[model samples]
Target: MSKKILISIPIFILAILSPVAPIFYFGLNTKKIDANIQRLLKYSWFDELYSTDKFRHLFFANKHVRKKLSSDIYVKLLSHHKKTQEKFYRFLEKENNRSN
Candidate 1:
């Protein structure tokens, strides 16, 4: 009975592994996925990704992965916007102070 159990376990494992082998093979070839992500970043269709369904879908599909990606993109954009606004306000303030 012990021998029979050992033999049955190997057989069961092999049977399960064979069917799932293709999935492993496909996942191992990750070049396509990397390329797709690169393309998405480089050629962003929307001026702001925050409002796009694709960006929102990415967040919904995988929160942890999307959080890092979204934060980096958002930070850069927000920082640039803040800098521009700061410069504009400084210019206006300087002019106002000069006239006084």
Candidate 2:
């Protein structure tokens, strides 16, 4: 009886938690995925590639893909790029000031 109860308790716990496991997994992975996407977007070639209609149609045509990319992801990538550019300019300014 005790053995059966112990086994059932863990099984019950597992059943309860299984559905939520993906939420936690994806939550942890979201940042890594965002960083990788941002790194890829930082390249000049990526901008050129993305500018082409073929590339945009291939990747962004699907409704789900369009929604995901056009919404938060696009905004986040633009903001990340702006911030990186700002940092670069600041570094350049500091170097110029020091030289002068």
Please provide TM-scores, in order, for all candidate models, with all chains considered together: 0.29, 0.33
For candidate 2, give the lDDT of residue 51. 62
Compose the digit string of candidate 1's lDDT tens values, residues 1-100. 6999989998999898988776576432234433334544453332244345434444234433333334445434534566743453354345444545
- lDDT score, candidate 1: 0.47
Give a tens-digit lDDT track for model 2, residues 63-90.
3333334445554554467675455335
Candidate 2 residue 67 Cα shift, in angstroms, is: 13
Show where candidate 2 strays beyond 4 Å: 39-100
TM-score of 1: 0.29
Off by over 4 Å in 1: 1-5, 16-31, 42-100
**Model 2 TM-score (2 dp):** 0.33
C-alpha RMSD by candidate, in order: 17.6, 13.3
